[model samples]
Target: MNRPAARLLTFQLPLAAFLVFLLFPFYWMLVTALKPNRDLYNLTVNPLWTWTPTLDHVRRLLWDTHFLPWMRNTLVISVGATALSLAASLLAAYAIGRLRFRGSGVLGITIFLTYLVPPVILFIPLSRIVSALGLWDRPAALVLTYPTFLVPFCVWLLLGYFRTLPRELEDCARVDGASRFQVMRYVTFPLALPGILSCLIFAFTLSWNEYLYALVFLSSTDQKTVPVGLATELVTGDVFQWGPLMAGALLGSVPVAVAYSFFVEHYVAALTGALKE
Candidate 1:
């Protein structure tokens, strides 16, 4: 074969394999969600492509359970946590990245190091704090606890983005009688839109998918987030409700997928630390 043809085959083969590996779980979930219980268990039929498709699982998931309430609870917690983390991270990033204070380097490293601390270690202490605040078994517990991990990563990410921006811009604004707060509001934030959106996506996705904290803090079935709700409610000791479980998994992922699709450009820009003007 020609060298160009061989090179094309080499790259395309790996690319196709990677795509299949990444997407096969989603395909499995879709098929499992649509398969009837009998078909789901039947050894005679192929499990990958069900001949008898049914919406019974989806119907039962919606009508018989508190799926909608779980969705609402997740939405509220994720949004609240994201907003709180972003606001705090934005201010903290500006101070660390631009303020040029003594020990600022150590402070920045310290903040990033907090993000590296495993959640498993933090959750025990956080659970006690949540209970002490009378937020046990409440969505408020998650909204507050999520930011403990989220804020550090966001502050670190936004600090990098802020560093790429020129400090002279803020100086120019301050020269025109703009207060520090006003400069941040009108100048820094507008330029950091990509980083802000990236942080929002990260924080929201983290909070939405969080299971350990939700499982520990929230006891009521109605207050559970989708991840915790699906895992706890869909399994009865040894018996797993595979159909409804897959259905919940499929539906639970749609919102985050749509969000990433919409803001993917900005997300990429943030990761690359690139900004226009």
Candidate 2:
């Protein structure tokens, strides 16, 4: 074979296959959402394509379910959690990664170790804490609880990123008599933007898709996140509502998809930087 043809087979064909593999779920969801009930249920019909398309499922998902409220709750919780976690993680990472202190290394490792602990093991105690705080069935509960996992990972990532930053710049600022807080606010924070953006994306995505904590803490239909709401509200026992379910799933994924699209470069750069440390 010609070199150009060989290169095409080696790279382009695999790239195309990988793209299809990643995107097939989305295409299936779109096709299912658009499929008419008759075609959706008909055993003889092609599952991959529908001749007749309808927006009925989308309409049903929007109007018939508490999807909008769920979305709002999810957005509020996700943003709140991400903001809170980032603030805490930033301070913690800066202190551990930059400041010279005893036990800082041990503290950093401990924080990252906390992230490895499974959420399933923590939810029961967290549920009680949420209830005791009278935050049950409220978005604030998730806003608080999500930070448990988010902070540790964010701290770990930011710690690595902070280590990669030039310490000499910070020393120069210090020599100029800039206070620690001022130095961070002016020098380190701006340089750490990529790592911060990566943490924001990770925290937001985790909070957005979290299910167990949402299910345990939020009892109201209006208070649930998309993941919990879609699973519990869309299905009626053994029976499933595939069309509306798929529609809801597709709609629910858009914000996260948009977020990744916008910040993906920073996310990649941050991960690469962190891994180097």
Candidate 3:
């Protein structure tokens, strides 16, 4: 084979296959959501494509179910968790990365190690904490608990990014009679915007899709997040509402997709900066 043809076979073919593999789920979800029950259940009909597409599932998900409320609860919880995690992580990362303090290196390592602890294990103790605090079945429960996992990862990422930044700029700000808070506000924080945005997106996505904690913490229909709401309400023992379930899943993923589409460049840049140190 010619060199160009070999390159196409080795690179383009694999790339195309991977793209299809990655995208096939979304395509399947869309098709399943649009398919009528008759076409959906009929083994004789093509499963990949539907002759009759209907909006009944979407309509049912929006009108018959509490999907809109679930979405609102999810949005509130995700935003709250992301904001709280980002604020705490920024302070923790900056102090560990920039300040000369005793055991700062150990502290940073310890924080990152916490991220490795399985969330499934923490959820059990967290359930007790949430109930003790009277936050169970409330969005506040998730907002507070989500930081257990989110803060550690965010701090680690921010610490690396902070290390990559030139410390001289911070020193220069301090020499100009600026306070620590002022230096952070005007100098370090501004430079660290990309990393912050990356952490925000990550935290939001995790909070949005979180299932175990959401399932355990929230029992009310109106208080549930998208993931929990869809799973519990759309499936009844042996029966699965496949159409509405797929519709919910497709809709639930849209916010995260839009978030990545908007800030993907910054996310990549942040990861690059963090990896530099």
- Badly placed stretches (over 4 Å) of model 3 are 272-277
Candidate 2 regions with alpha-carbon error over 4 angstroms = 1-16
TM-score to native of every candidate shown: 0.93, 0.92, 0.95
lDDT of 1 by residue, 1-277 (tens): 9988897799878899999999999999999999999888899888889777899999999998888899999999999999998888888888888887999889988988898888899788888899999999988898888988999989888888897789899999999999999999999999888778899897888888898999999998898999999988888798888888899999999988888899888777765663331
- Rank the models by lDDT, top first: 3, 2, 1
Q: Model 2, 86-192: lDDT tens per residue? A: 99999999999888699998998898889889999999988889989999898889888889999998998998888778999999999999998999999999999
lDDT of 2 at 254: 97
Tens-digit lDDT track for model 3 on 1-277? 9999999999999999999999999999999999999998889977999878999999999999999999999999999999999999999999999895999989988998898898888888999999999998989999998998999989988987887789999899999999999999999999988788899998998889899999999999898999999999888898878999999999999999999889988777766765664
Residue 263, model 2, lDDT: 88
Instruction: Assess each prediction's global lDDT (C-alpha) against the native.
Output: 0.88, 0.90, 0.92
* Clash count per candidate: 0, 0, 0
Lowest summed lDDT across 10 adjacent residues in model 2 is found at 268-277
Q: Show the lowest summed lDDT stretch of 10 residues, model 1.
A: 268-277
Candidate of highest TM-score: 3
